[model samples]
Target: MSNVLYEVRDGIAIITLNRPEKLNALSIELGHELAAAWERFQSGPERAAILTAAGDRAFSVGADLTDPPEIWPFAPGVGVHVDKPVVAAVNGLCVGGAFILVQFCDLCVMSETATFVYPEAKIGLTGGLITSLAARMPHKLAMEFMMVGEPMTAQRAYEAGLVNQITAPDALMDAAMDYATKLAGLAPMVLSTIKRHVAEVLPKGPSEKAGIARRDLQAVRESDDFREGTTAFREKRPPQFKGK
Candidate 1:
């Protein structure tokens, strides 16, 4: 089965990560598919997009260690900049690299069973690039999560304003869709312009704006270690990245 699935209904395009067996890990294939989907969503007839997953276990376990960055056209900001709108319907564990995906969405509706974390510290890697976007959380709380590598429950995330709403796992999609339907009805031009305008006003720190995300992403994107991670994954063995 494909790692990513795309469908459109009633002016809304829904992209589902299909690798339930692997907790919907963000593989290279899924990345490319997602990039393509974004491009289509931008130019296609859909007025909005809903990103979701197929299984109950994970909205996404995180980025697939096996896939190369360029394998898919999608990157942090490359594939598409729809401005049209994107919503995240987060169910189950939204950990590690998985959180990156949600961070890019316009709005998010998380399930009560969902949780968030940046476990890169556990793996001896820095999460600087992705963590830069975690500014939605309080400075102390964000620092605690990055430093301690502990998981935060969905309820805590909502209370902290990191997430919009929390409901049962089964109701997660409906809740997101309810919001999407509302967004779809607004004036498209007005909504898109507002999003872009607000993005321009947000204060980005010197370090954050100093190409930090680009530098960090480049390190992994071009590393021999990344290749090792993918090879080992394909062989069903743990990766012994050389940090090359």
Candidate 2:
């Protein structure tokens, strides 16, 4: 099944984390599709995007246990440079790495049922990308949220300025769409400029920088020239580089 679904309404793109059967876990397949969806949003005519999940029970429960994914796909300002405004409509559990997804968004309207969790510290595992949280919210609160590994309720998330607003589960998408619609009506160039500059102002964590570097390195690795060079070496012949 396709793990991500992209739709557009009135110039606003709606990207769904569609793995309800698995609670929209960030599996490898889902990660690739989500990355493609972000690329589409960057190049498509859509003026803004609303990121939400398929189920009301959870936006995402973090990485898939048996099949985790690289951090690039989930990254917006980091690996994926998306200038358009993005809003997160989070429902229930947004755990661990999943919380970073919400963090990268421009604004968020979370459901009252939603709770944020970062259990990496307790699990003897950690993804340093979560450090971006400090740049998003109060440093002390971000540190406590990551180090303590407790479930942050919707109200606390709002009070800490982690989330912009909180609404009923049924009203989550409506609130996100409202934000998207408003953004779509604004000047696109101005919005993109401001978004890009804001990202520059924010301090990027180590893993976040690595994610960006990975994107560049991955392109070269996947390029046709890379294949040609390898094949030529095997044949003991001069390689014809296309500069791809």
Candidate 3:
């Protein structure tokens, strides 16, 4: 079965991550499919899109450890730039790389049971996601998440202005679709123009930002801490991080 699913109806493109058994963990295959789905939404008749994932356990637990890690085309707000607005229907656990996807959406509707986290520090990786979180939220709160690797509840996310709305699990998709449909009714050109304008005023171009992330990621990968972290993760033990 496909790792990702895409369908368009009523001018709303719905994209779903389909790896439920893995808690919707993102693999290289899924990433490619997701990028294609975004491209289709941008080039097709759809005025807006809704991003979701299959399963009640997770929106996405992050990257799939079974597959070699590589940059996905849909790195959100970085690699894939959608001219039309997008809404995130966060149903459950949103962690690590998954939170980056949420950061890219123009609006978010998360289930009350959902949680957000960035565990890059614990895994000894860093860069764009860390910087992006700081840009999207208060510096202190962003630091708390990035540095401490703690999970943030949906209500906390709402309070921090990271998500627009929170709903019961059953109502999550309905809320997201309702919002996307409303956005779809707006003038397409106007919406596109607004999105473009916002992008233009951002501190850096997407490519430049991505380049910085790549450089930082490379440095992290070469560090001893990275090897230790990965080893500990595989061994199911706490990592011993050293400044080296």
Worst 10 residues of 2 by lDDT: 70-79
Which candidate should be chosen as best, given TM-score against the real structure?
2
lDDT of candidate 1? 0.75
- Across 1-244, the per-residue lDDT of candidate 3 in tens digits comes to 9988998878799999999999999888888888778878877888989999999999999888787344435755455557899999998899887887888788999999999988888887654544656767788997898889899999999999899999999999899999999999999899889888886775563444765466467558889999999999999999999965
lDDT at position 111, candidate 3? 99
List of clashing residue pairs for candidate 1: 32-72
lDDT by residue for model 1 over 24-63, one digit each (tens)?
A: 8877778777777777788887777899998888888776
Per-prediction tally of clashes? 1, 0, 0
Per-prediction TM-score? 0.79, 0.91, 0.82
**Model 1 error, position 141 (Å):** 1.3
The models' CA-based lDDT, in order, is: 0.75, 0.90, 0.83
Which sequence of candidate numbers ranks them by TM-score, best first?
2, 3, 1
TM-score of candidate 3 on Cα atoms, chains taken together: 0.82
As for model 2, its CA RMSD to the true structure in angstroms is 2.5
